[model samples]
Target: MGATAIVTRFAPSPTGHLHLGHAHSALFAWRRAREAGGRFLLRIEDIDPLRCRPEFTEAILEDLAWLGLDWDGEVRVQSAHLPEYRRALDALAARGLLYPCFCTRADIAREIAAAASAPHGPDGPLYPGTCRRLSAAERAVRLAAGEAHALRLDMAAALALLPAPLSFAEGGTRIACDPAQFGDAVLARKDVPASYHLCVTHDDALQGITLVTRGADLRPATHLHRLLQHLMGWPEPAYAHHPLITDATGRRLAKRDRAATLRDLRAAGRSPAEVRALAGWPD
Candidate 1:
């Protein structure tokens, strides 16, 4: 492939310390941008105020610098950009593609259990269309009562608004999109103003990101993201979903595995070069 001016971003949620898996992802995005002489940007996805912490955000920057990863512009902090996401949500709402969902986790599970067989999606058993069936009066009453609710994309309605056979560029190939599988994915939750799908798609477009590099686990989400981009009339960026780094036991690295954290490895006297090699990136 010829060198193109791509703009890639390493967006990490500040929920925990940086692990080897994070190192590999950050390095993967950084390498792709550096190789093409593109811009590598950093973004802090700290929308979840309950789980995310300022200390972890600072640690992420420190750990990435320690791993010899340097990004190009000022980091885009999602928590600091609420209005942007709100505007995107408002746009979808105005088009009658979004509805307020009042179902709790237990409520959803109960509804799914009542069904003969609940359909499964990328996130798990798809959300049963409980709130989508509510009468306008009932919805208005709940909103008047100040009931906690989430904004979900009415998959069927949103699909009706867009043209069929949505697709996105992946590794120079056009992959067909299947967004209905998500089944009314949440765009804004009661706790967080914006969900991952909403924030990521909005930020990628606003930041002018030309290339999105992440783990293969999130590849399924690209389908929904492509739909969101189309709905909001945002440009679709090329995607590169790399395989996740796994442990000796073949399990993917996670925050619970403290031994795999960069801080632990650094404390064990491992140099940056050694850590980079361990993270599957050798200088």
Candidate 2:
């Protein structure tokens, strides 16, 4: 935030072993920050306590160290930062930018299927504001009775008050977030502290992330984070969405892609150079 050239972070949720796509993003962020004489940090997005495992987190640190990438300080984990997420959530809620979403996964899926029966992209269904239209009295009635509901940012409410023509750089694509392209994205997982969209925005700014490098598949989300930043009075950083390393089938490698995982490679006696080269990155 001060005189630092730039600050970038590789925040991997330690749910599984680091795979090819993870390596690409890590190298891209590490190189980008280093080239700019900036600080590179590591953050463990372990907010999903249900899925996060300490063993996987340790493996990530080991793999990154093996890859010759170093972070500036002790790793920052999102699970340790719930108070921060809560503070940001409260701030946004006070501003009327976020609303409660009572729809469950199945309910949402049905609504989405109905919408997509007409037409929709791979991003999933548009939230029909089933909860958005709920009056304050109605919401409180449900809340008083102990209803489980996640929080979602009101796209219409946010767009109406915020500036338009929002855009972000995706490799070379000037991907923009039109009001119609995205729906009310969940911010805080109901009952849970923070969702990915909310935490990423909060942590990126709080941790002073200068550049964000992730898979191109998440290109559409840059806009959501961008808008959230503005609403929360957080600074927006430069972003780089790298191409995902995929298999011969054109499927992007994931943690379940066992053959591409660092563990599998290491067990196969693959050197650091060879492992990085698998993602087309230099050792």
Could you say which candidate leads in lDDT? 1
Q: State which candidate has the highest TM-score.
A: 1
Q: Mind giving the per-residue lDDT tens digits that candidate 1 earns over 4-58?
A: 5888999999999999999999999999989988899999999999999999999
| Cα-based TM-score, every candidate | 0.97, 0.91
Candidate 1: stretches off by over 4 Å? 1-4
lDDT of model number 1: 0.93
Per-candidate local distance difference test: 0.93, 0.82
Residue pair clashes in candidate 1:
none
Error of 2 at 141 (Å): 1.3
Model 2, residue pairs in steric clash: 7-210
lDDT of 2 by residue, 67-136 (tens): 7788898889888879988888888899898888788888877776676353343476567778998999
